[model samples]
Target chain A: MTHEAGIPLGIRFKLLSDTPQDSAAQVVNEVVIGDYRDLDTLREFARGCDVITFDHEHVPTEHLRALEADGIPVRPGPDALVHAQDKGVMRARLDAIGVPCPRHRIVTDPQDVVRFAAEGDGFPVVLKTVRGGYDGKGVWVVESAEEAADPFRAGVPVLAEEKVDYVRELAANVVRSPHGQAVAYPVVESRQVNGVCDTVIAPAPGLDETLALQAEEMALRIAKELGVVGHLAVELFQTRDGRILVNELAMRPHNSGHWTQDGAITSQFANHVRAVLDLPLGDPRPRAEWTVMVNVLGGDYPDMYSAYLHCMARDPQLKIHMYGKDVKPGRKVGHVNTYGDDLDDVLERARHAAGYLRGTITE
Target chain B: MTHEAGIPLGIRFKLLSDTPQDSAAQVVNEVVIGDYRDLDTLREFARGCDVITFDHEHVPTEHLRALEADGIPVRPGPDALVHAQDKGVMRARLDAIGVPCPRHRIVTDPQDVVRFAAEGDGFPVVLKTVRGGYDGKGVWVVESAEEAADPFRAGVPVLAEEKVDYVRELAANVVRSPHGQAVAYPVVESRQVNGVCDTVIAPAPGLDETLALQAEEMALRIAKELGVVGHLAVELFQTRDGRILVNELAMRPHNSGHWTQDGAITSQFANHVRAVLDLPLGDPRPRAEWTVMVNVLGGDYPDMYSAYLHCMARDPQLKIHMYGKDVKPGRKVGHVNTYGDDLDDVLERARHAAGYLRGTITE
Candidate 1:
């Protein structure tokens, strides 16, 4: 998707792929196949690049610091990226900044987890590994000490947080340039299914205007506070009491902002490119009254082209985006976006197209 | 641009680029570096490809026929493509179909060109080669027999056309599927400078509604009559008396439709991809009330990045699209699109950004 956004800017991409069949590798012309974890490989890959950025935050912090020492410009440099790479660091930083967050503390063992949970909301606490986690992996909700043993079994440092009763999930997407210029897209409601993002609606229909502005401000402040560059997706929880808490932070374009591709004046991916390159940011205003995005998860059927045809025929206004990945059950292979005056109509249209493309709906 | 559109659709492009530095070759991963005119190269490139399409109409007609004989689905098949490749065939066909066209005839020599001009609006007749011409090449506007001798020197059949005293140039862009599904974009005013397209304004501000509809209908009819599958751009000369005359025909996406990339609901390139792939076509409606596109021709400055940064900072809403081509004097390397409710604002913004990007305008 970043490659797609870069094309019109006349930007050339030199990608480092783990395999030739990787989704991005299928499209990018200049690709070096190597393990990103290897310092030597990272050095070789960064040789001719003007600025280095990422789609994933898995590159080791030490390697990024090394690259910076070697005079390579690494966006969202290791100091800022570590907040996203480690939950403990993120929680500590947010606490220091007085940003609203779930009550959290580092726990050493199952007994420590019990103590941490008791200090907060008690039992049913969320325990997350400080590193190497995504899409709901490396996190657990335990009701008791016995149930908490599972999170400590991995032997990695864990952070326990009070599980707040939230009304729904929202995302505040913002882009920040190295020069500090920034823009925030409207807050959006995000729905998750089986730990993966399923749908997103821009402006978060029926959201309080004040709360939306607050979320936007909080996201912008987070970007500045962390010295982050590029896209900052603040996954948020809107509590039943009307307070919003930061749930997670991502330093790259996130799934929740995909609707901007067809809905906003500037897409998140495009703005991310602009931000990382330190070019002026484009407008983040919505182009339509309502925009809905639904993910097309891979399912029982692998032949999606026929379904894609059906969806296109069904809705001429539908914008379908597919990642060139071989279909695998439950994997996000594509998404559909629809926008119009009526939110219900747009939502239904997007949902139908995504379902059809995923082969979940026949007619 | 086609490659950029194909990315979101997950279409894998196999480009047959004449050089490694060809604009499309720079982005597309699967590229075969070879001369497209070579029959063996074309055949080898076509193998395993689901269909064959083109960015240019220069591929030999006979070679396309051979490919069709080999059972490859060639869009805008040789028969339909020949009209775009040969001006004489195009003029004759449009005349037979009762489509309005500039007065033209095949001229044997300079003396015949003079004779042909006498029958029409007299001197200042335009001369065009029957084959191999684009962007003002292989074309001449002669005031007398002596000036007409240059076109005959090419040895190819020359087409003599009366230079219509046009009030303005307009373009009707349409896309047609092999299954006959077709959609016409709103007619746009095309402004030319030194015979090259300089700017395009969608919905042709102040255009007569009836004439705009007539032009669109004419383009749609021409697409059907020619059996064109994919985009067909009918360049028109809106006469001083309000009649629209066919200026030229392009079987693939044309420069006049570049505004659709950021101005329309579905871009011409994306629709062309859908049409060629036999997929359902997308909507061809303009997204804004007024949209303007200005071509950024290469100029004295070869370092465009600094100029690009300046333009982006100047107008946050301006959308710039570069073709990834090396800068060369008077060559089209990129374009800028600006759209909004006010036509004048849109036009000025686009022109200024384009001029700035071309290094022709400072401050």
Candidate 2:
């Protein structure tokens, strides 16, 4: 968000949003209420900016190409961004580069889905729409042919893949520059609840040293191969066999790296700006031995600020970041980060603060 | 500034300035072009705010009291703020509370200044206007009767004090909430060049442990005695005789505490906001053993961004905080903060980045 870049570095940020009430629009310097799909609006917004980047990957790629063709610099240009925008493209590209990924194939017929499952572990293959999916949407774990028919109803190209038997989900975040420089953060364990990221622990406690190193190297390689000129987050699956499989790629700052805001020497947001601007990358060293970050989801509490006093008073070391948004049930309203020498203590503090904010815990 | 507070916490900040072109206006949520001297304007501006605070200590105390009387929350109320606004008041109160301060007296006539000089060390006494002075303004080191006439020109009462022969200057910064909770930061050595703060070294390298503890206690005591509702910076003179004399007090975030942005667990700006809002204060612990901060004054270079690539590339750990302002020679445009385990290395990196930004150093 502009809060991360504009404040610390004093960058003049102008946001383009569909409405004035967008969380970022409320905080940035200028807000142009317009649709990103409209080229005229995009041109008008780009006029005042030195470089163009993104918070979401849903922006049309052709529009980005048009802007780049007009001599405007677009970070993580369409070539690299498409891999995140389309699952089919990402799977093919990773396969070509010998990157570990789940067995996948673009399927026009439901029979191909069954065949993929039959060739692999059989049934319960992952079906994805390949485009326009986020936060568990357009994704399904199908066991039988009847359940697989749901994805085909959307009339979009469906990508079927073998669901790996993984110990846990992990994320390796890195930022790259146009100058061929890149820095990788420690691999972290990301816990999900109802397909939404609920908590993340940096350095993935008890993770195999070799696997952690391999995850970081794989992310760095992806940044180089894809020519990603900004933050690249490579979500991975740590299999029971100790092999790492690439699951997803995000070309912007990821939720898994949010702990870096307070725990790392230089935050991922600050590094993202530097990478996109072609400035030197910052040191991705942790300030503490262990850091735990827990997302604060909206619940029955409408006035979030009311809970701040107790949370702050209870844990003075916790760093809470709240997005300026109207609270909605199950929405990610904010996050709490706690870091220290003791992993258990840090985790307890972070989880307690987050739970308190969500009105799930009280004392 | 609001840029640091507003952006990080998603707070809607509206700054009241004399002009729309003020650097803070360029980055804040809104700017109301009005004079702080105009009570009507202040009232109108306060109508939209929950709480009121300031960046400078020059605002009329009477106006602040009036706003508080009207049910608006004025942090560090007029009673506490006046100590920082007037030197005579601060000296009298600190003296009454047995706080260590230079021998001083309020003088109405020029002859009183001459008599005070004779009573003290005889000649070369420090004379300062009791009100409306900052950054070397309204202060004079008078050695003769004729030299004392300059301060009378301001038509304000002057305070004369013994000129302490000190080894160096130190600042102990602390923040307090309305509930009387306070946290003290590590004392830092503040180096002044031409009456302006040039660089600050946190934990004051080679400083005695007892002196550091005494400085922090003094600052905390001052905050408690004054009922300060936000940040209180106690500037002290570290005499050659191993004594600490209170030199000045600031009721807001001071330049001396800027090192906290990158060095400490919680920044002064964040603490100030927390204090004013009556939220619990954050931990004031240092993230590193040593931190060095250097101010960047504008020089011959009109294009400051042109030098950033080199500065960032050279020292990726340097945290640069630039004020969105036009380049004016000798004007404070930005600052750089560097922290590490090595004091010498941290100081070198900070100085190099700041000097390069000011075009004082090349390569």
Candidate 3:
């Protein structure tokens, strides 16, 4: 949602999905229930929209090219979006551009994975599918060659790489317009629990100024080299030795940038809209010294509103953003942002609010 | 317009308007084209809504009381809203509660107005209709009995008040829930041009701390005394001798609080929704040292989007809010907010952005 009133008049959101029950369908101006795989359905949806963008990277790249050929404005185009749609393409492109990444190679056979593992430190190799993987699915850390066969059974090419010894994960979020204008947000530290993002802190507490600048520059260079035109979230691994390596890339708003909604001078969603429309970018300055965001995963509690009294009274400064979805075990239903001068206090407030909403903390 | 997503799912908006072309009707989930004066139509609309609220105060108070009698939730109820709907009632209530106000009286004849004016400093008394006036309409500064005849033509009770010698006007915005939880925002200086609110500066720059506290306390007291729920905007006149006099009151989100959208930790809109819902109130802290909001009146230009490139590029930090109204001469179509450390810089940026949007400034 946008903070500015009357924006709904200029924004005519037409959501295309297989069912009308999609969370996005509730707020959009129109909903087209159809199969994304069908070119005719995709074309029909594109016909009514001035531009076409995506919340997911799984849409067939050829269909995006078809829309572009039909004179429709498709942000990030087929060429720039392919890297996000396919992991193999992204790894190859980043390597060619000399962007630092883990040592890896595509393995067609289980034996090839074993050989690659042996070439580095024996056993415990990171394996991933070339396509259709998200939130740690289709990824595995195999300790032996026998365990590596699970990825090959899927009949897709497997990517094998050395699991770098990293201290933590950082995300460099930047938005680039079609006019080549770009602005980078401060690097943030992202914490993962069970392969899902749990928390993110802006400015990455105690990060070296020189390293922070380097991370921003790296993300900016990647956005320029890929010709990506909207939000680009560059996930990085800051190794124990202080070197940064690219882990993944997303072409749209990512979970790591959620803190910017309540903490920054301008949110990533607003910047994404501006970039897609080719308008001038807004300042990405932080409004406070520290901001902590925690994801609210669906748990024991199904009634989020009932918890509002306790949360609001406990921490009046917290800003909660809920995504309308049926509560389910381990599902992400919402998130909370807490910002202030004290990092520890902000973190505690955000964590407490999120935990309370999830029913993980009764008191 | 809400910052939190998924609010549309829980709150399905059904707008009751006279025409389908009403701008509010376009974004809401449903629309009933019916007259507010028709009891049957109002009853029908009320059947589908969980509660009833208003954007304007013109709806008859008795109809609202009838709805409340039927167990329909009417926020700020008729008793509290009538103070805003009728000038005569508001004046009497303020006087009974010992709230400081201008020397005033309800006059049945033109001679009564003359007597009241003579009892005061004489001549130039402000004459107003007891009900139904907005935006400089139904209000006049009468210099003589001949000038006072204009109010009699309406055939409504006239209110006569001594025109106080004041330094400037200020607005104290506060939100109260049915549960008795209330939060007050920083008092703001509201500037008027041609009797229309033109600009607002948060914290009423250069205001004395004790006086600011007094204004907030007075607004809070008024809200409690009137049993008001939802947002309350208390308009005050700062006398040249360092005292505040109540001028008027509004029971909904007032234009003076628009700067809170970008300048405050919790905006007035969000707080208003929380208050009406009877949920815990949010913090009312200012995000920056100073915030300046300037209304964008319709001027020579009709194409606002064309000016975005210039304004956005020139002031990357400026926040603009449009009302989606077709541009007409002197109409309030939108507003711009600029904030930062320096008051002078913030004021200039806000004025420049608003002037540029109205096509009143070239550079």
True contacts kept of each: 0.92, 0.70, 0.40
Relative to the unseen true structure, what is the C-alpha lDDT of residue A191 in candidate 1, on a scale of 0 to 100? Answer: 95
In model 3, the runs with Cα more than 4 Å from the true position are A2-10, B2-12, B18-23, B29-34
Residue-level lDDT of model 2, residues A51-104, one tens digit each, is: 998888988899999889888899989999999999999999999999999888
- What DockQ would candidate 2 receive versus the native complex? 0.68
Per lDDT, the best of the predicted structures is 1
Instruction: Name the regions of candidate 1 deviating beyond 4 angstroms.
Output: none
For residue B26, model 2's alpha carbon misses the true position, in angstroms, by 2.2
Whole-model lDDT, model 3: 0.85
Q: Can you write out model 2's per-residue Cα lDDT over B230-320, one digit (the tens) per residue?
A: 9999999999999999999999999999999989988998999889888888998888999999999998978988787788888877899
What is the docking quality class of candidate 2? medium
* Best of the two (1, 3) by lDDT: 1
Q: What fraction of the genuine interface contacts, i.e. the true contacts, does candidate 3 reproduce?
A: 0.40
lDDT of each: 0.93, 0.88, 0.85
Each candidate's chain A: what TM-score? 0.98, 0.98, 0.96
Candidate 1 lDDT over residue span A36-122, tens digit each: 999999999999899999999899999999999999999988999999999999999999999999889999888998898778768
Error of 3 at B16 (Å): 3.2
Candidate 2 runs further than 4 Å off: B1-3, B6-10
> Interface RMSD (C-alpha) of each candidate?
0.8, 1.8, 3.3
Q: For chain B alone, what TM-score does every candidate structure achieve against the true structure?
A: 0.99, 0.97, 0.96
Clashing pairs in 2: none
